[model samples]
Target chain A: MAEVKLTNVVKRYGSVEVVHGIDLEIAHNEFVVLVGPSGCGKSTTLRMIAGLEEISDGEIKIGETVVNNLPPRKRNISMVFQNYALYPHMTVSENLGFSLKIAGKSGAEISAAVANAAEILGLGDLLERTPAELSGGQRQRVAMGRAIVRHPDVFLFDEPLSNLDAKLRTQMRVEIKKLHQKIKTTIVYVTHDQVEAMTLADRIVIMKDGHIVQVGTPLDVFERPVDTFVAAFIGSPPMNLINGHIEADHVVFSDGNRLPVPPDFTGKLADGRQVVFGFRADVLMPKGHTLAESGVVTDLDLKIDFAEPLGSESILLSTLGGKEIQARMHNPRPVNEGEVLTCELHLEKCHIFDASSTKNLRE
Target chain B: MSKFSRAIRDHAVPLALIAPSILVILVVVLLPLMFSFYTSFTNYRLIRPDTLWDWIGLRNYQRLLADWDFWVAFGRTILFLTVALNLELLFGLGLALLVNKITWGQRTLRTIMMFPMMFSPILVGFQFKYVFNDTIGLVNNALQSLGLTEFAIPFLVDRWLAFFSISFAEIWMSTSIFAILILAGLFAMPKDPIEAARVDGCSNWQVFRHITLPFLMPFIFIAMTIRSLDVARAYDVVDVMTGGGPAQRTELLWTLIARTAYDDARMGRANAMAYASILLSIFFTWYFFRKLMDARKHLGAF
Candidate 1:
């Protein structure tokens, strides 16, 4: 295992610069996920680290040596592509042992490695099957097996689970997490799915528009997103942002609705400063019910536009201070649309962003 | 009113739809094939119409069996097919690999590469005939100007040189058929396998040999199957360039058949030779098709 470090890495296609100078450091045996929307340069950054793409400017070190000029093979890294990228003509065992074969290892050593990977991936029965004969989930496992057999310094996965169905994707995601635990190698995985990053990454790197927006542990980023983009991007049902301004110890909405500032940020804001009030759905549950967070709470009445009951929890779509918002209800009875419900907001759990720059105000 | 007539009447629309095609086939294909097969057993000559009724059973086949010249031509034709097809494949593969690398002006280069394939084989034959002319040809002039030799090289006269010259023209005209098809194969090739091979620690050549070449085999066999049937069409070029002369050095099957049928007016012998050459075509087509299927199976496409 080796530490993968990128200092000011940049990627440009002709006159168009797609990946701006970005710095990242993935420690030895750490699982770092690069998550972003399409065209956000997460995949490009991963490819550059893999040496499949050239860095326009920067230094990438896979241990003690800079690998900017190294070819992908010489870089001693393995990649699992979104399509699984298995050799269609070869059987699963051959695909798993291809790197070892290329490295000129003895047949016995290659087979041993193949057998180990197959056993780990539950691919013993699939050794003789070609890629075309395998299902999508099986092919994904073979791809992972192929990567592991090489024992490269780092593993790069580019949306490897995106092609599978939801159940299979979830299963493979858990399998990948288990694989990482077993192998204990540095991994730089790129995906647009925040849930994958949240569940699997030791450190999650969130990017947008070619820039690294934030890099933190999943809980760190979830608890304290550095900016509005990270806040909205890293959660499902998304964080709600209400446009408002700080005025006299209270946030004033454009439609004249006002709420006192949470006690945590009592003195952090100046009067008349425009800001975005952000809160997560789970925090604003029905009164008297809170998840893990216990803090100073505020109560507000919201007219429900719709309610989605998910058995243990329900997502209530409503208007807060004249802006669309989603609140979570814990073990609550189903409520009718347009019903007025009082929900509690864990004041300390909410986020506030500067309106002009969109950075977290309390960061 | 009968059962058969009633059945036919019941399928009248479908029968009517197919009748024209069947009639056309009988008139244009089946009749000529039957007439040719019949002539192969008779002493039919184009000049002597009365020989049409003469039944000389197996006489032409018996004479051809012992004819040393016929055997030599047959052997030469096989040699020509093998050498020309292999050379074309090599050059075509090289050209495709080179063209696939060019990012700029690739469209223009591909269009230019197809220029030879666009020219008629007869036109290409005439073109090369002048280019290889013993004295005034471009090749001889260039050699003379460079002081390589005092006498012009007999490119179309010496037995081996004439064989080389004719095969050159054939390869030049049809190599792009392989290139175009192989390029399409290259275009359709997924980038993931090549990338996977590279990540698997393969060098450039290894990646090409193990991944790219295997991926291209099915396309190569497809091109071979098509060109095998059409390689006979090179008769026009060979006829114009060497005319099966200089001791029959470049005598392909079709050239020999054309000479026997038209030049010697021995239609019966030519038809017999034509029937024998048809077997060669069928064999090549069958061989290439089997190879195509094998390649597809190896790629797990089947």
Candidate 2:
């Protein structure tokens, strides 16, 4: 295993720069995933690391050696493509042993390597079968087997599970995680699916518009998002944002109602300044009469528009001060559409951002 | 009408549209084939049209059983077919590989390569005939001027040289057919497997041999089958260049058959020879098709 480092790596196609200067360091034996939306240059960065694409600028180093000028074969990196790319002409054994034979290994040694990989992948009985004879999952296993036989320095996976059916993708996800754990090799995987990145990555690099937005542990980026973009991108049924203006010691809503800011946030704000308030859906709850009657509760009256029952939890879609809001609650209460309800916000979990720049207000 | 009758009525329009084509085939192709087979069983001669009605069963077949000239042309035709087909495949594959490597000016080069194929086979025959002429020809004149030969070389008179010349002309005219088909196959190959092989630490040659060549086998066999049939019945080039020549040394089946039926007025013997030559074409086509199917099966297709 070897640590991989991309120092100011850049990729350009003609005059268009797709991947702006990217610097990333992947630890030895770490599974780091580059997660982003489509056209976000995550796959381009992975291709550059694999030597399939040239490094237009800066340097890439594997361990202590610079590999910017090395070919993919010379770099000793194995890549598993999205389509499984199994050789259609050869039997399973031949496909697995092709690289070994090309490396000038002895026939006996090549056979032994292929046999070991086949046994590990549960493909021992399929040595004589061509790729066309195999099912999709079986073909995926052969693609992995082809990579495993080489025992390369690093493994590059370019959305490898994207082509499989949903159920097969889940099973293969676990299989790939287990394979990485068993091999203990440095893996740089690229995928547009956030759930896959969240489950498989030791550290996730979230990208947007060819720039790395945030690079941290999955929970780190989720709980302490760097900006509004990350706040909206990381979670399903994403974090909600409501517009308001800071007025003295309170933030006033659009309908002329006011809620007191927590004491910690009192003196830090400027009056008459516009800001956006953010909170996760799960942190908002139905405001009880005791809190409401105390006259000190920070709550908003909302008109419930719809409710989506998700078995154990339900999502309540409501409108507050002419802005849409969603709240997740575990207790399934029978709430009618257009019914008015008051929900209390948990101040500790709420975030505030500048309305103009969309930058987080947290210190 | 019942459902079956309605279905037949629904298909009647298409069948009516195709009826004229079926009638044309029956009259133009099937009738002549039946007439030739009938004539092969009779003592029919082209000079006497009345002999078409006279039937002497197996007389022409008996004569063909003892004819050495017909068998020699048959053997020579087979030899020519095999050699020309193999050479065209090799040259075509080589040209495809070289052209496939070129990224710039590819369209221009492809157009240029097709110039030879655009020329008619008869025209290519005349071109090569004049080039290899013994006297007042460029080849001998150049050789004599360079002191390679003191006397003019008789290219058409020598048996081996004449055969080689004709074969060369045939190959030159048709090698592009193989190249174009193989080039199309190469262009359609997926890039993923080649990349995977490269990442798996395969050399360029290894990737081509283990992956590229096998994928191209089906295309190569298809080109071989087509060119085999064309070369087996090669007539225009050989007819124009040698006309079965001074002593019938360069004679092939079609040339001999043409002479027997049209010149020597023996339609019965010519039809028998024609029937025998059909076997050669059928064998090559069947063998190549079997190989093509096998290659596709290996590639995981039905």
TM-score each candidate: 0.97, 0.90
Per-model DockQ against the true two-chain complex: 0.64, 0.64
DockQ category of candidate 1: medium
**TM-score of predicted chain B, candidate 1:** 0.96
**Fnat of each prediction?**
0.68, 0.83
Candidate-wise lDDT, in order:
0.90, 0.87
- Residue pair clashes in candidate 1: none
lDDT of 2 at A363: 59
Tens-digit lDDT string for candidate 1 (A39-89)? 999999999988889999989999998999998999899999999888877
Q: Which ten residues in a row have the lowest lDDT in candidate 2 chain A?
A: A288-297
Model 2, B181-241: lDDT tens digits are 9999899888899899888877788788878898899999999889888888899999999
The Cα error of candidate 2 at residue B100, in Å, is 3.2
**Residue A243, model 2: Cα distance from true site in angstroms:** 4.6
lDDT of 1 by residue, B81-175 (tens): 88878988899999999999999999999999999978888899999999999988999999999999999999999999998898888898989
